[model samples]
Target: MAIIHYFAPMMKMRIFGLVFLGMAAACYNPPRNCNDFKEGEFRFTTVVGENEQTTTFIRRKSIEIDYYQEKADTSSIRWINDCEYVVKKINPKTPAEEKSIHMKILSTTDSSYTFEYGLVGSSKKSRGTAFKVN
Candidate 1:
């Protein structure tokens, strides 16, 4: 009888702790500073076939030029919003390369943004974090 009384309060406390934790997690939100990431020199790092690669790009309001592996490629940007845009290769050399890519900033910090991107009209998505260099 005494053990039941002791365990009942312990169980209630445990349940209350779990509820508090869940509420805290549910209310958590990531920071965003969309305007800071809109136009700048940025570096994006990703893994490709067991190798890590980083690409650097300089963006203006409507254009971006990417430098990677001794090559430079330019793209036109169409803004959907302050935090979202579509990019198309300005001088694509192949059909696959001509597809416009959809990009959306998921969250931002003072110097970086987490983004999700995919080819326009495609369901597959990829995520990357880009850091502002300038």
Candidate 2:
């Protein structure tokens, strides 16, 4: 009886350890896939500290991305699928510099999608999941 009592504690400890390890493994899992996020046009709007901005993009051979805000003219970027692109500010200011931005589609679902992107000359990396508009 004494031996069974001592082993009971060890058995419970082992089972508890297994449960924790299982949860940790699930947390480290990768996303589903990236195929779903490709080949589509998307529009996104965000309210950043009382200022609202919108972005539109078409993920195609001639990929086009545009940005617009209140009281500002539309700006745009034209891209080719060869991992290269050109960006221009369409407003009449400064003749719009030509720059390049890096973007990658991460994973997607029926109503939401995630991506990794960065603007030109900026070292900050950005990632976010966005929902489709009705």
Q: Identify the candidate with maximal lDDT.
A: 1
lDDT of 1 by residue, 1-134 (tens): 99999899999999999999999999997887788987899999999999999999999999999999979999999999888999999999999999999999999988899999999999999999999998
Compared with the true structure, all predictions reach lDDT values of 0.94, 0.58
Measured by TM-score, how close is model 1 to the native structure?
0.83
Candidate 2 wrongly placed segments (more than 4 Å):
1-27, 70-97, 120-123, 132-134
Candidate 2 colliding pairs? none
Tell me the TM-score of each prediction against the true structure: 0.83, 0.54
Candidates in order: C-alpha RMSD to true structure:
2.2, 5.4
Candidate 2, residues 1-134: lDDT per residue as tens digits? Answer: 99999999999999999999999998884454444444456677667789876766554444343435434334354554433344455444553343445665556678667666776768886776655543
Error of 2 at 91 (Å): 11
Model 1, residue 24: C-alpha shift (Å): 3.6
